[model samples]
Target: MSLMCDARDIEVNVTWPGGPGTNQRLEKVPSRFAFAFENEDVKGMEEDCWGFGVPPGARSYGWFKLLLDKARKTEYDVEDVAGELTNGLLELPTDMTAKEVVTAYLTKIYNHCMEMLEQRYTANILITTPIDFWLTVPATWQAGAVDDTKAAAGSAGFGTRDGDTLNVITEPEASGIAILTEQAERNPELIKAGDNAMICDLGGGTQDMQILTIKAVKPQVQLEEAVPGQAGKCGSTFIDQQFYQWMEETFGEAFTNLPKTKIGHGSKFMKDWEGVKAAFTGAAPNKQYYVPLPALGQALGATGDHGVASTAYDFMDNAVVLSGEDVERFFEPVVEKAFDLVDQQVSSLRRRKQGSTKLQIICLCGGLGESIYVWKRFNDFCKDRFKGAVKLFTDKQAWSAVVRGAAIRGLNGNTVLSRKAKRAYGIGVHRPFREGIDQEEDSYHCPVGGKRAVGAVAWFIVV
Candidate 1:
């Protein structure tokens, strides 16, 4: 097998062109490395790296296409979408919002990153030499690319409800890439850590569980995608699904019956999908949600009848109460399977133990890692089963931790240096009418250009 290696594994901080609230940044330090040569496979490894709701992976792209039904909506003018909500992450996009357009455009790149991450280590084996590979590019770059590729792509208007919202901005994703690349260059020693550790990147959209087992000569993060591990398979989207179904059942046609309710809103399932998706990643298969029905009804407005035309608050009281039992019923098997996978890995590790090498830290980064239920259950299982020998890193920064690590990694790529440490960055954009459009954009920027680097590259990824 030919080995594809770059002397410097660049780091980067990815972000949006305009800036925060509408873009994303690495919330944590990241890791990057060159793909090495295995028997017949080209392999390199990274840990704790993740591309959430809109990951840059083929599966993600495929998933987006399946959800959008793009073939049926030829009139969709993507450039017309725009937004201006603060805590933009909290704001849902209307069809007019830029979220949908940006997401569709970004999905292609997200899939590209996923492909790169998957193949960087494994693809080279199929080839014969250390060839240069292109990681995914961010949206601003895509802006030009889309204009050249899409038939409807054109000068678009921007607004929140109607007009321009975010001020001048740079692609946050690109900014993240630049920072991460620089960080990686500054601190190559951190890459050496890959030899011993594995990454657990649990996020709002998906639980990206990767295993980086260090071999003496070869050190890289291996995706345990094929093999299940102790990590839960579900994600925040799971909870959202439950909430949606429950609302649909209780409210009946009322859920979407209001005059203001647009049929297209239902298509934006990805918003609440995060709830269910996050639930699946927890140590326990079960999760609970106490959504105030009235609040939902209010959001739905005239769409819901409230059974008796009663006050919205009254309707809220009648709403269903989700429980662990309900969650377990749907997620138990998946959770158990996750544990089983982890057990297998542990067993494998035990067999490989030669003498007395100490185990490394298993860091958990991502929104799901912050799940109280998940952490409690996972903690209980680890202590009881592993006898507390295994260490799981659960910090408050857990949700945005991977981006933090990615940023530090990006910083390492640059010439600036102080001491060794870890940290993160980014903004979130929400699309109301599209599938899987709630994307996080990197917000870090190069002071010089006031824009993010062209593509989002990073030195190290924790998940």
Candidate 2:
């Protein structure tokens, strides 16, 4: 099937806890919001799908526990001592109940997905819902950071970096739950027990590598409960941030001085920053703005400024080119490490003396993995180094693979995790190492003294 479509087809991004709902919706291929509201379409058939991470500070402790425990007996008495001691953690406004927050969170994720899906590509939705619940726990949740003990002890407790900040950290793991559940339900037979598979989830913000062990007869995938730091923050947002910073640095005074209008009561900040950036990046030579160019020029201290002129071309060229380059450089380290991971897995298999010498298939799925530059590098590396052992699976459907997988899992929850596989690989830093953007290899080392060592064994599960 032709996966490429016009970008306008995708209208909105819909996010839910990963599961059959999302998977079914993805398969339906929603290109408009009308599909979501017109029919009682629980699954967003006419919309493009994508997932997002709740700000590290907003995920629910109760939901977090439920996810870690796979919805087991994880609830605690709200009246207990620990609960009373941490009542402040549960003090969100009455209108912002946990459920409301979750729904809104999903909605925001959906909107983000839709915006990205519609930009520079054709699709109904871009799905971030992954089969793996990728999360990162702070290396140490000390007293000042959060009450790790209370959180672990089943209290609805929260922690923070500063005194007033609430640190209900939600890593990528929380985002994947919505998509995985959707996939597990659709393909019970193909995904049956004893099947060992690795999920390569490329999200907008991070890439998650998960190992799933299928049960002997079940359809569920066994997941590790612990957090791992293997994932990197190579999200596309880095590009946006770079662009924003560039704009700020180049035209902060002029841009900020533009008349500001609060929309929907301050929920949305509407200014012409985007217009200015667009006019600069677009092929058009000149674009007019509501705010006169002379005023902006005066603010920018430009010598002969007239009405909105064509200078945006130069501004965009300089800023966009730099941002693109930075995007590539930002991902280089992670790309290098990704190959290193594949090598480690391959080496492990070779040691086992398995009869199958054929290389394991390495699939690429996620926002970061879809980058042309990253994909080219990975494909070239695999082809040159491992011969045919590496396979970079890129289909039109690949971007939404995680959500589809998640949805499939959810529908098949009854049969999920019925299979098992041996988990032997450890995804952790082999040594403490840090290096500047262009530093030499010898410059990489631990900040603290002595030889760098593996910090911790990131979580993995057996099939």
Please list the C-alpha lDDT of all candidates, in the order they appear: 0.35, 0.36
**Per-residue lDDT of model 2, residues 1-463, tens digit only:** 5432222232323433332244433322211111122223333334322222111112122222122222222111111122211222323334444333333333443344445546736453323222122113321122222333223322211221123112232222222322232234443343433333344555433444543333343223343322121343333333334443443454554544443221100111212322332223212223333322333444444634323323432343221122333334434445665665555445544554423333434456555555566567777887898685554544344455444443333333322322223344567654443444323443335557544444546666632
After best superposition, candidate 1 residue 413: deviation in angstroms? 5.3
Candidate 2 clash total? 65
Which numbered prediction scores highest in lDDT against the true structure?
2
lDDT of 1 by residue, 1-463 (tens): 5242232433333442222234545342211111111111211113211133221111111112112222121111111111110012222224422334344444434445445545655655523332222222111122333332222111221111122221211122222223223223454344333233334544332344433333322222221111122333243434444444544555556654432112112122332333444554332344444433333556445554545334222444633345556554444433444455455545644555343233343444455566666666667777888678665545554654444433333333321212111122333332222224322253334556443323333344111
All candidates: CA RMSD (Å): 22.1, 18.7
Taking all chains together, each candidate's TM-score versus the true structure is 0.39, 0.39
Among all windows of 10 consecutive residues in model 2, the one with the lowest summed lDDT is 262-271
TM-score (C-alpha, index-matched) for candidate 1: 0.39
Which runs of model 1 end up more than 4 angstroms from their true locations? Answer: 1-104, 107-196, 213-233, 246-289, 295-320, 323-334, 347-360, 413-463
- Candidate 2 achieves a global lDDT of 0.36
